[model samples]
Every structure is written in C-alpha cells, then in structure tokens.
Target chain A: MKGWIYQLKSVRKDKFCIMSFFLPVLVAILLNFAGSIDLSSLGELQFVLTAGDLTSETTEWLARYGTVMICQTEEELISEINDPSTNLIGIEKDGKGIKTILSGDEWAILQQAAGTLPLLYEQRESSAQVGVQILSRPDILAGYQHIFAAMTLVVAMFMGCTFNAMNIISEKEEGVVFINEILPMSPKEYLIQKIGIGFVFGCLSALITAAICFRLPFARAAVMLALLVLSAFVSSLIGLFIGRFSNGLMIGVVYIKLVMIVFMAVPMISYLAGVENRILTFLSYLIPSSATLEGIMDLANGGTAMAGKDTVILAVHGIVWFLLYLLLAGRGKKQA
Target chain B: MWNHNKGNRDPARTNHRLTGKSCKTRSIWKSLRSLLQKDFRMMRSGKFFAVALGSLLLYTLFIHFAYVRFMDMEIYQVYLYDPAGTQRNVSPLVHPVASLEEMDRILHKDANSVGIHVTDGKPEVSLYTASKKLDRHRSDYALSLLHPGGKYTPETVGGNNLEQKNRRDITCELLFIEIVAVGFLGIASVLFKEKQMGVMRVHAILPLPKSLFLFSKIFLFLATDLVFAILLVLCNVGLSGTGKILPGLLIQTTILSLVMALTVFGCAMILKDFRQFSLAYLVIALFVTAPVFLSANTSIKMTWIRFHPFYHIYMGLKHAFFGIPVANPLYYLCAAGAVVLLFGIVKTAFCREMEKEG
Candidate 1:
C-alpha cells in the first residue's frame, strides 16, 4: 500500500509523466482532423508535359486523364521529365511519329494510365466494352483513421513499458535499490508493485485513447479494454525483466526498441502492406503486443473471433515473462 | 604597492605572466582531449557502437533479403474469368480463373485485386470497393490489360530502375530515422549518465570552459553519424556511384546530426531525469517527425508542411540520394542559422545545469 501510494505521489508530481498519460488523447484529436482530408483524388491525379503546341482536340483528350502542361521546346519537356521529384509523362511530336517520355519511377497504375491514354485516343473510343461493378466487403478493415488511431493507441499502451523501465533505472541511479534492501519489503513485492503500477497506467491510458478515438458498442469496447489489459500485463512484465537486467538508460532503451520493432512495427507493417506470408503471420501471432494489435484491429472492424486467440497468447506471455522476472529478482536478492 | 618597481623592469615577472596565459590555453586543450576520451570510453562501455553496428547489419540484410524482394510485386493483381475465351490479346500478367466461385474466393482473400468476368464477348469488372478514383484506376488497368498490344510503350527518361530507387529510398529513410530517434536518445543517455554521476558539477570547478564538454559530445556523435551514413550507402547502395552522392549526403547528415544532438543536449541538461527526457523524446519523435514522413512519402497532403523545418531537411536528403543537389540557398542558410541558435541555447543550459545544487 505504501509502495502504491509512493508511486501515485511520484506520478502526480512528475508533469511529464502526467502529460504522457494524456498524449494519446491529444494524438487522437490530431488524427481526427487528419482523417477528414480526402486522399481519394490522388489516384486520378497526374502531371502530363508536352513539347510544342498540341491540337485543341489532343489537349482536350489529355485533360481527361489529368493536368496538361505545355512547354515551348523539347528541352523544357525533357527537363521536367528529368526532375525525379515530379512524375511527369512527356510527349514530343516528330515528323515520323510521336515519342512518349517517362521518369521510370512512376507507379504501375500511372504507367498503365499513361499507356492507355494515347491508345484510347487513337481508337477514339473505349476499346473494351467493360461494365464495372463494385463489390462491397463489409468485413474489410475501416479507413486509415481507425487503423492509425488503433496504432497510436497500441503505441501509447506500450509507453507503460518505457515508463516502468525508466522508473527502475532511476531508482537504481538514486540509490533507492540499496536503501530498499534494508527495508521490510521483499524485492518480489517491490517489483510486483512497480509492474502493477505500470499495468494500471497502461490500462488507464488505453481507455482514454479508445474512448476519445472510437465510438463502439459496449461489448466491443469491453473486449478491447480486456485485451488492452492483458497486453499491458505482458508489457509490464517485459519491462520488469528489462529493468532488472539493464544497468543504464541506453541499454534499457535499446531493449525496448528491439521489442517494439518486433512486437509493434512488424505486425503494423504487415497489416498495412497486406503481406500474406505465412511465416511472418505466425511470428506476429507469437508476440503478445502484435497479437493484441491484431485483436484491436479485428474489434475495430467489428469482428470478435480473433480476440480469443490473442487473449490466450497474451496471457501465456504474461505468465512466462512474470516467472522469468521473479527468477531474476530472486537471484539478485540472493547475490545481495 | 612599491613592489611594482621590480615588476616593471624584471624579465622574470614578464615571463611568468606570459607563461600563465599559455598554461591556461594548454590546460583547456588538455581538458577537452580528456573529456573526449572519457565520452568515447563511456559510449564504448554502453555498447552504443555495437548496437549501431548491429542495426547496420540488420538494415543491410533486410534491404537485400526482404525489402527489395517484396517490392517486386505489382500494385494490383488482375484476375479474369473468361469461359467464352473471347479475350485473345489479354496481358500475360492477368491470371485466368476457372469459375466465378474461384474469383470470389480470390477476391475475398486479396481484396485489392480486380476480377474481370467476360460473358458473350463483353468484359465486366468487379472489385472490392476502395475509393471511387482508385476503383476507376483499377478497373481501367484491368480493361487495358485486355487489349495489351494496343498499349503505348514510352521512351525511358532519366531515373534509377525500380530496384535501385527502392534501395536508396529505404536507406535514406532508415538513416534519417536512426539519426533522429536513436542518435537523439543516445546523447541524452550519455549526458544523463554524467549528470547522475555528478560529473557536470565537477566540471564547474575545473578550469576549462564548460562549452568544451558540449563540443566534444556533439563532434563525436556527428562524426559517428557521418561514418554510419557512408557505410550505409556503400553497403546498401553498393559500390557503384556512391562517390557522387557521398558529399551531399554527408553534408545533410552533418546538419541533421548537429541539430538533433544539440537539441537533445539542451533538453537533457534542463530536464531533471531520464523519465522526463524520455517523454520529451517521445513527443519530438512522434509529433515532429511523423508528419514529415506522411506528407513526403504518402499521398496525404498537408498545406502547412512547407513550414515544417524537418520537411526541407528530409527532402534535401532524399534529393541528394537521387543525385539532385538542393539549389535553394535559403535552405542552407536556415539550417546554419538553426544550428547556431541551438548551440547558444545548449550552452546556456549547460551553464545553468552546472550552477544547480546537487
């Protein structure tokens, strides 16, 4: 109880720690604003450069694709095409035929657009009588807003791990470890208090983030909250393990970065890139944070089937890491 | 006071004053050298270089083994279900599906793919709904593949092939992240260690100027980052044509390294402990760097990203990687001015920290 009270006092006094607790809320608001900006038009946007005068008919036809820029000489057109920063498809007319210039780094879709324009112009009509039908998949993940929001929430929850590690290192630096050795409390109890505080803060921060960013029904919200708690427990144990071994801030940070890259970045990137590699998928599921991310994303997309597996993985990780931390703590006590 | 008569004419007194000035200069140089050595030893003990080397190896392996291979995939896959076999000139890239059920299963698995169902010599395109514009592009791409021979082939202009472009692009981004994130935290960790050890306070009573302490660290990290940039280019970008880009790349790395190192130096000096600095680091890394990446790399446009300083720096580095020098004189001026301003702030903070009671 004293330990918890002391931690509460420390966190209350530390303005930065308090700010960190609210950072997710702040980031969620920012993401909300960003989400309003429409990026759909980017797919259709293109820059077309032409040398000399184009027939009015040609200009009108080119305008169907995107913006058309006319340059006085072939030199100007080539210059624009040479600028790797801009993706411009250049057209130059010669006596024999027309030449099309490309920067080579254009997207495959844009390249297809470039190729189809001239052909479609020559045909003067759509060659393939294609009727386009849009199939709606209700099970697909939500827009970038929710994905980014969930990512931010997950990253914010892991802040508990960082804070816990820093807390232990700071205590060691301030000679609190030696002072605690002579106190009545056992090291196991002390370590548990630290990890417990971290777990509690992680849940609180995650709740704030989820509440501000997402509006879900009670059951989904409750499931998400439960998953985040499990994630927090596993992360706190990892933090406890890291803090027990690492002597300095740099090493502690290095360990945290490696953990985050594996547990957070891999799953997020795979999800974003739509990677279907089985080995990568298996590896992602094995990591507790990655599993939690998958669960959170599933819940955000209105699916609950995957949460069961994620909960099992996180619970297993929590137990294994906690036991390892206890073993390390016991050895340290014996050495002292 | 009458002893001034001997001092005015005595060579010994004059020599003593001269020697005193020279001794002070020598001691300052000696102190700076020792400080540099100590920092180097501390970094070595902290395994910073080992970590950096490990990162370099990992990045190299990833670029070669994974990233390049993964990028070879097409933007969108096209599947065709043509029972009538009416499309004689279909692109070889399109996959032929046996039945409508097969197409549905594939579409469910690969949501981004477009399916063309041809019935009675007419093509019908179906896809999972993305954006309206992207959907149009995907459908257009799918239809264009039907008459592959009619597609116009363009003359190639200047630019690296897709493989080289991906390599350099990823290398630049990783290097930027390494400097901005890891290097920033590294300097803070070293400084915080010194602060905890009461070494900064000890420097106050020493005869050397406090600024050397900051300079040694800043220069050490700058040199380390520059070397890392060089090796990263050589390893990932390969030996071919690295010489041309090294100068501009190193210059950009120097500017970024100095700015990050000095900013963190100032923050670490002012902040009371590692926990506060960690929070500060998080804020800077997330809020400051995230937008620069999103605006530069993605289609997400921010009207105000031009005002962001790191945007220009990041673009400059990217251009350097692509063999385009930043011709804007204003950029260099601003970077230099920022560096100078940060140096002043850090110096003041270091002095204030030195004056604090332990």
Candidate 2:
C-alpha cells in the first residue's frame, strides 16, 4: 500500500500526469457552461410559445381600433367588411370554392383575417385534405436529452480512457516501467497500483464532469462518483492491459483508440438511430462506459441513484474486466 | 525407403487430391481456431464469462427493482385553454384553464407541455419547437382539437402506446450504448491483453491468415452482445411484443456490432495507451456523442447535425424499435461503406502494430 501510494504520488508529480487529471474536468465544465446556454434558450423558446396563447391584450386593443367583421356567410362576410364590426363564423366546405359568391374587399379582408388566427381554408379536389404532421414539445426535449446523454457518455468515456491509456504506453516507451519494476513488488502489485491510479484519475475526471456539465444533489453526486470509480477502473484495466500487450507507443495508440471508437462511440450511434430494445439494454451493461453513461443519464434526469440494474451491471462489468486484465498481465510475464 | 514409398504412391496417382484455395481455407480455419483458443484461455483467467453472467444477473435484478419501476411515473402534463366554451366536448383529461395567462404559467413551469390557446375564437397551439419533425405533430394536435372526434384520426400502425414507446425507445438506446461503448471496450480490453503479451505480433508470423485474429474477437463480442440484447429486450419489453421485432433488431445490432468493433480495433491500433485513448474517448464522447444525443433526444436543434453520421444511426435504431423497416437503401449503403472503411483501417493498423518494435 505504501509502495502504491508512493508511485501514485510520483505520477502526480509529473506535469503531464497532473494535466491528465484536470483536462477532462475542464472540458466537461466548459461544455456544461455551453449546455446551460441551451437551457436558457429553451426557456426563451418556451416563453415565446406560451406567450402567443395568453390573452392577447393586442386583440382586445385591436377591437377598438379596426373594423370588426363578424359574419357567417361569404356574402354577409362581404357586406360586413364595409360595416367594420366583422368577425367570420363559417365552415370551409370541402371540394368547393368558398361556396357563396362575395365580391369587393371580402376576399382581401378574409385573407387578412386568416393571417392573425389559426385559420383553415378548403382547397376543392377529388380527395379530402387534412394537414398530417405534428410533434410534441416534451417529446422534442426528451429526444434532445436522449442524444445529449449519449454524447456526454461518449465524450466522457473517451476522455477518461484515452488519457489513462496513453499514460501506460507513453511511460512504457519512456522506460518508466523500470522504476516500478525495481520496486519490491510483483507484477500484480505493479499492475494493481497503476489500475488504482487510473481509478483515482477517473474519479477526479468524473467529478469534474458531474460538477461542470451537470449539477446534482449530494445523493446523486455520490451515486455518480461510485459509477465513475467503477467505469474508471474498467477503463484503466483496459489501458494497462493494452499497454502491457503493445510493443511500443504505436501499438498502444492503435489499441486504445479502437477501443474508444467501438465501445464508446457506437452506443451513441445506436441512440442516434433511435433503437429501443431489451437486447441493446442488456448489451449496455456489458460496456463499461454504458453504465457510466446510464448513471450520468440518471443524474441528468434528476435521479439520486442509478436504476438498481445499471449499478449492478456496471459493477459486474468492472470486476470482470479487472480480472481479465490480471490474467493478461500474468500472460505478459511469459513474453517479457 | 519412406521416400520411395511416398514417390511410388504419388507416381500411382493416389486419390488424395487438394485445391490450393481449399488448402488456404483450411489453414485459415486452423489459424482462427488456434487464435480463438488462445484468446479464450487468456480470457478465462480474466473471468470474462463470469463477468458477463454476473452482469446479466445484476442487470436483470436492477431492471426489475429499479429501472422499470422508476420509469413508471407519469406522462407529460397537458394543459389546455378555451374561454368561449369551444371545447365543451373536449376530453376532461385535458386540463382546461380559464385564461391564457394560466396556460403560459403552466407551460413555463412544465417546460415540456404542448400549449393550446384559442384566440380570436380560433384555436392556435404553441409548443417549444425543437425539430422540424415535431412541428408536424404540433400542427396536427392543434388542428385536431378544433373539431372533437373529427374524422382525421391517425391510423394505428404498431401497438406501442406512449409508455411502451418510452420503454422500447430507452431500451434501444441502452442497448446501443452498451454495444457501442461497452462492447468496443470488451474487444479492446481483450486485445490489449493479448497485445501486451506480444501474442498479437506472434500471430503475424503464424501460417494462418492474420485477419482471423481480429475476426475471432469480433465474433465473440458480436455473439455476446447479441445474446445480451435478446435477454434485455425479452425481459424488459416483454417476450411477445419484442418477438415480432427480434429478427430485425438482431440484424441491426449485428451490423452495429461489426462496424463498432472494426472501428475500435483500428482506433486501438492508432492511439498510444489507455491514457491517450481515454483522452480521445473523452473527445469522442463529448463531441461526436454530444451532437448526436442533443439532436436526437432534446429540443435543441443543430441544422448541421442532420449531416452527422450517428444521427442517422440513432434514428435507424428508433425506427427499428417501432417495427419500422430501415427502407432507405442509401442508409444501408452508407452503413456498409462505414463498416468496410473501418475494416480496412483496422487491417492497416494491425499490420503497423505487427511491425512495431518491442
């Protein structure tokens, strides 16, 4: 444990390592600030939309200023146009041109009236016509949040893994492994220390993400932290295992980069494509970042704890990957 | 004496014959088997299967106890206003307020309501317009309210209601998220393990085709992901309902699985270590994922996001869930192109990885 602490401390002392811990947090925070801008815009759009419904003081004011035309028929509508107190009350008949013949400013007045209120006019043809497309606001917001959550998970996981993955390869290339190798520890201990360091780094990054990108209550924050720890551990194991297998920085780079694209990016693609199925959900537990993302989504949705299933899924996933990492490390001994 | 016997047999033209391509194919299989065997052995100690099983159990429990329960709360709080008694026949479920100010307040507080205001004795509805797609729905609702029980009822296609829609929608998202993010890591983590042991490089000099090394892992991940998908859908969305859509969903999942695996394989080869990879992952999660999620799931619209590749993927998944066929040939073409492109990149990266100095 002392040896582990010493190694972690030494890693922190390195400027690059220090930057690795903070950069994602900074980015997440920046993005959070940016996301908040959308919130304000959403608020503005909401206000504008709802504003149109409220008693249009202007309509009442217009009643005193302009000629009011209240007519049920086209001829009456035409006659009332000159009389000023005109409002139209008539059904637009199907397959016919305004049915009743009305001359003068009736057409112009009706056209002008149609502009203010939600008006429907009949276009006469053999087939009936009803406007056929509609969408709800909440559904729109839900879609936005869905996509946002996916993107957040992707970016967060990518940053989380890349920084951790690079450290392993870069250090190996720099012969930094020698220092740890020289210490009085087995390869297992060494691997464990590195994994621990990555976990801590991930925790810090997740905190940064939670703090800057989202604001949650303490209960939610704790749940998020727990998820971050597991996610980071799994990611670290992947990085360390890849670093161990790789011959140099080049191989290491390829390995980690591909992992991010496949594991992290594709899930978001699934989301973009609007797939909803139990199979995808089940698969979600298999991916380390998926849990992190789910957790983040729960937090984003104002939930304090991750849905019980997501937490268990992520935890199990992390443990599984960690063990696989160990086995791989053991195999590393034969080649080394 | 042995050489004479063999020469004599050959001179006699024994029935034992072989084609070069068949020989190549057999050797390729042998190589694949060996590679898969080695990976399986390595992954065993790593408890890969155990983890999967545990994840299955855990996710099952959580879904039953947590996720399903949590999502069972309420629908969008709908608020309506018509002062002239125009909607006397409107459903009582629709909350009718006396004034427009009340509607504004409710919408403001709700932030997610479809606001309907009858002004100048004509009903005009307003909602936070998020997408061009949603604009159509708003218009339909506004027009529908004008005549209660009108003949313009939208034809029922699939049996999914609003809640079921949410269920399937979220399920698909979680699944996609899992395969894309988690499966990618699974392949990488396993490969990274092998790579660290210098076994990947060893495969290069083997008598078998090198592609099998990548294929075996992809196959394993694809299978695992597919299985997980099956269970998740069956368990959450119900067996009977998901049954009809399973085959199509599986095909879509497979396509996604292969594409993501190849892409990650290429990326893992090109990047440095977990740290650097994590940074890249972060960038991807933030940028690529952010725009896709924002555009797909939220009210925030980026007109440019329609051009994004994942946007189509997300919409495709959504369509797939609702039993909608991804009828666009162009979509399939683009997805195939992406997969092929990623595969080529992975092959190139694999060669480069093989050439790297120890």
Candidate 3:
C-alpha cells in the first residue's frame, strides 16, 4: 500500500497522463456550456415568417414581440398553446387565415400592446413522406448529453491509453528499464504503479466531468466513475501490451491506437445512426464508452437507477482486458 | 533532315532513355502488381476477409429469417368511420368501425392505422401527430379513401417493384452501415499496419508521390467497397432490379465509400492511437452518425437535421434505394466537393504521421 502511494506520487509527476485525463472533461464541459447559451432573439423569427411584409404593413406593430414556433399539423396547435413560449406570442399561417393559437394571458398581452399580423398558413397534404420528430426538450437533451458524454469518454480513453501504452517502451528507449531492473522494486510493481496512477487520474477526471459538465446525481456519478475506471484500466493494459510489443514507444502506441480504432471504434456503428444494430448491441455491452453513454444519459435525464448489469460488464471488460494485456506484455517482454 | 535523324536515333529508345527509364512501363506495371498483391495478402491477414464473408452470411441469414419475416407482418391498417355511410367506396380490407369514438379507439389500439374520421363533411384523416413532413401523407391517405373512383396510378419512374423496394432499402442500410462502421475501420487498420511496419515513413523517401500513398489506399478501399455494394445489391435486390439501377446505386456507393474511407483515414493519421481514435469515433458516432440515422430512419425528427451532412448522406442512400434519383445536380456537386476536401485533409494527416518521430 505504501509502495503503491509512492508509485502514485511518481506517476502524477508525468504531465502527459495528467493532461490527457482532464483535457477531455474540461472541453466537454465548456462545449456543453456553450450549447446552453440562450441565443433565441425575437427579431430572427419575425424576419423569417413576416419576410418584410409585417414591417411594411404595420408600422405601429411591435415587431420585437415574442414568436412561437408552430408546426403545420393540427395536433401541433394544442402542443403550442400549452408551450411557455406561446405566452404573449403571435401566430402566422403558411398560406391563409392566421388563427391565433395563443390565448388567455398571452392573447391579452398580444391584444393589449402590439398590433398582431395574422398571416395565412397554407396546408398542402401529401401521402408519401417519412420523417423524424423529437417530442420534447428532455428527449433532445438526453440524446445530446449521451453523445457529448460518449465523445468525452472516447477522447479520454485515447489520451490515457496512448501515454500509458508508451510509458515502458519509452523507458526502454532510454535504457531506464536496465536501471529499474537494478532497483529493489520488481518490474511488476513499477507497471502496477503506472496502471494504478493512470486509473486514479481517469477517476478524478471523470468525477470532475460529471460534477462540472453533467451535474449528475449520486447514482449517475457512481456509474460514470465505474465506467471511467474500467476504461482507464483496460486502456492502460492495452498500452502495456503495445509497450512490450513494438521496437519503439511511438510505434507501439500508434499500433495499439490503430487496433482500438478498427476493432472497437468502427464496430460502434449504433452511435452514428441513432439506432443500435443487433450485432453492435451485443458489443456495446462490452465497451466502456457504451457504459459511459448509457450512464451519463441516465445522469443527464435525472435517472436514479444504477445499471447493475452494465457495471458488471464493465468490470468484466476491465478484468479480462487487463489479464489479456499482462499475458501479451509478458510474452513480448520475455521474447525481447 | 528530322526524319533522317529520328530514324538514326531510334525514337522509342531515345524517349525511354531521356525519361531515365529502364523498361519503365513494364516496371510500373510490375510495381503496381506487386503493390496489389502485397495489399491483398495484408488485407487477408488483417481478418477483414473473414469479417466480410461472415458479415455477408450473417446479414443474408437475418434478411431471410428475421427481417423478411418481420417486414411481412402487415401493411398500415386502414380504418373507415363514415357515420352517414358516405364511405361506400371504402375497400373491403378497410375496418368499418362504427362511430368516431370506435375509430379513435381502433386508432389508439393499433396506432399504425390511418383513421378516416368522416364525422360531418369531407373525411378528415386522424392519426397521432407524426411530423410536419408526414402531414401531407396522412392527408393524402384520407383523401384517397374519399375519391376511390379516381384510379390515380402512380407513374413508374424506375422499374422498381415491392421486392426491389425492400432490396434497395436493406441494401442502402447495409451499405451505409458497412461504410460508416466497417470501411472506416478498414482504412484505419491498413494505415496502422503501414504505420506499424514503418513503411509509412519509407514512402517519404521514395520517388513516388506522397499523395499516391494516400490515393492508393483510398482507391483500393473505394474499389473494394463498390464491389461489395454491387454484390449486396445484386444478391438481395435481385438481378433484374440491380441491373436497372446499378449505375445510379454505384454512383451513390462510390461517393459514400470514398467519403467515409477518407474521413476514417484522416482520423487514424491525425489521432495519436486507436484509443484516441476510438474517442473521436465515439464522438463521430454520437454526433454525426446518431443524428443522421435518427433523422433519416425513425419518426423522431430533429429540426436541425437539414444542416447535418450525414443526414443528407443517409437520405441520399434512401433515395438511391427507392430509385428516385436525387434530381438536383448540386447535391452530387457538394458530395464530390466534400470527398475532395476530406481527401486533402487525410493526405496532410498521412504525411504528418509519416514525418512523426519513431
């Protein structure tokens, strides 16, 4: 335990791993905050709908009044009326007869102050069209949050793995391996220290991300940390394997990077299409990013339930991959 | 005097010698052959051959056993609710549920059915709000039931039957899936192999153009993808259907294939390793692929989909499947331009990877 602490302290001194762990979390938080910026100006909607006609027709009309985004369907009327935006909002039709979808306090507000321009909305019905329609803010936000979280996880995995995988190989290049071999500490302890430090860094970064960017609940925070730990460990082992196999540190890192891209990244097609393929569904359960996404999505959407199965699967990934890495690295080290 | 000099000089020999060429044409051919052979061997070893063959079998099995079975379930159920018996022209297949309440119950029960609620006047089509784009469809469906006398036979734009429709949709989806997922990885794997073998750096010292290295990889992936696409279409869509639209489909495939391959190649070279690549991949899959897929396939509509590049690609694939060619030439122009732009970035990244310290 004491040795582990010392190892952790030494590993923290390595700036690359530390930076990789935190950079993605910071970027993700900043980007999410950027997206949260309220940029909906009243002038824009007026220009879009009125097209200079409103300005020309009613000079006294409050052009700066609030706008309502109306859907063409009749059902949209009910939804729009209930919307907070509809309070004190005006309406226009695509072709003719602009029935004010807004009523009550909003209607009174519109009637009292500004002259309303009721434009026609032309409804042309067709039979052969298919489209996607998101129902609410929660749904949209949930999707965006999942995507953002997954991206953050991916960036973190890449950065963490790249450095850790190259750690030993770079030491070998500088003949530090021989120096380390002369020390009282075993090589295994050194490798464990490195992996342990990487994992710790990954955990801290993830917690920070969840707290700052996601604003996750305790359950979600726990889930995210679990996923990050798994990812860190698995990635670190992969790095170890790469370090052992290649002639140079960069080559090993690059090679492992290529493998990760091909085997793990590409097969993850579900994220791209917004629909999970059956084959990929099975694989998603295996990947840390998948867990991160599912967990973070739950967090963002205010879900309280812990994903027990996912946690176990992630733990399994960490363990199995770690063992596989040790075996491969051990073989490569022996051969070298 | 020129003729005499040409005859004495042996024009072919002189031309060859001046070009610093020793059986240059032959060597070029030989080199190309060796390159192809080496690539073929490398590809086979990379497990792509097994993966491709396995994927083909798996997809085929799913299509036949699962997908086809599921698709055969039922067409959209039609409900007729004419209180005054105004819907006499209603087809026998139409469920004649009495009263508006009954019709509403049936629509709610099935949800997939298009209900013709002719309570008072002209028939009003009632279904849960699908989307603004699908509004026209719901209305047209209602109108069609009213005017049963007008045999409005759709004009056959291309020779595509129902089976062909299925084939095209499945083919486009499969191809899209393959390109978006598999081909992207395939390009990365090849680059990684070259990167690992230290041959990427070797290209820098070679007399052959650096662009050729990137071009060669892109060209090969494009050709492989095109061939896979053609086969997938032919096998599933039927020979007759594939024959009619193969040209257009191929055009779409080439564009998607090249674009995806270049994107993946650029990603692989620019990112540090597969871990980083995976992160980038996850981001791409989430932001790019997820949005495009959802916007294109499901009823879940993103108002911002119009701005998404992949959404256009997914739609383009769907359009290709339906045999309705994207009539706008500008779409193709844009697609081509995107491919070129992606290619340029990939090339730059590839060069950078080669130059990076070992």
Candidate 2 structure lDDT: 0.58
Q: Mind giving the per-residue lDDT tens digits that candidate 3 earns over B1-358? A: 9988767987787887967675776666576666667667777766556566665776677666755444422335677777788667665546877687887777665544677766555566676543332333333444454444322221122233334444555667777877887556656666666666777767777666666666666777888888888778777777866776777778888888888888888777776554455446545655677557655643343577798878777777776665557778888899989998998887777777667743
For candidate 2, lDDT tens digit of each residue in A1-336? 896677677776655566656765665565555554343223111101112222444333223222222344544433322221112322222242212222111222232223212222221111014422133334444445444544544455454455556666767767877776666788777766777766666667666665666666777767766776666667777776677677754456556656766676555644434446888866655666666665566666666555445667777877788788767767767777
lDDT of 3 at B201: 69
* Winner of 1 and 3 under DockQ: 1
Q: What DockQ was computed for model 2?
A: 0.06
lDDT by residue for model 2 over B289-332, one digit each (tens)? Answer: 65676566544546777788877876777667767677889998
- Tens digit per residue, CA lDDT, model 1, B220-283: 9998899899999999998875888988998899999999998888888788887788878888
Residue B333, candidate 1: C-alpha displacement in angstroms: 1.3
Positional deviation of B277 in candidate 2, in angstroms? 2.6
Poorest stretch of ten by lDDT in candidate 3 chain A: A39-48
Candidates 1 onward: DockQ, in order: 0.47, 0.06, 0.05
Q: Could you say which candidate leads in lDDT?
A: 1
Report how far residue B116 has shifted in candidate 1, in Å.
2.3
- Superposed by TM-score, candidate 2 places the C-alpha of residue A68 at a distance from the truth, in angstroms, of 29
Alpha-carbon DockQ of candidate 1: 0.47
Total clashing residue pairs per candidate? 0, 110, 32
- DockQ for the candidate 3 complex? 0.05
Superposed on all Cα atoms, model 2 deviates from the true structure by an RMSD in Å of 15.5
Model 2, runs deviating above 4 Å: A1-19, A25-336, B1-24, B58-158
By TM-score, the better pick of 1 and 3 is 1
Clashing pairs in 1: none
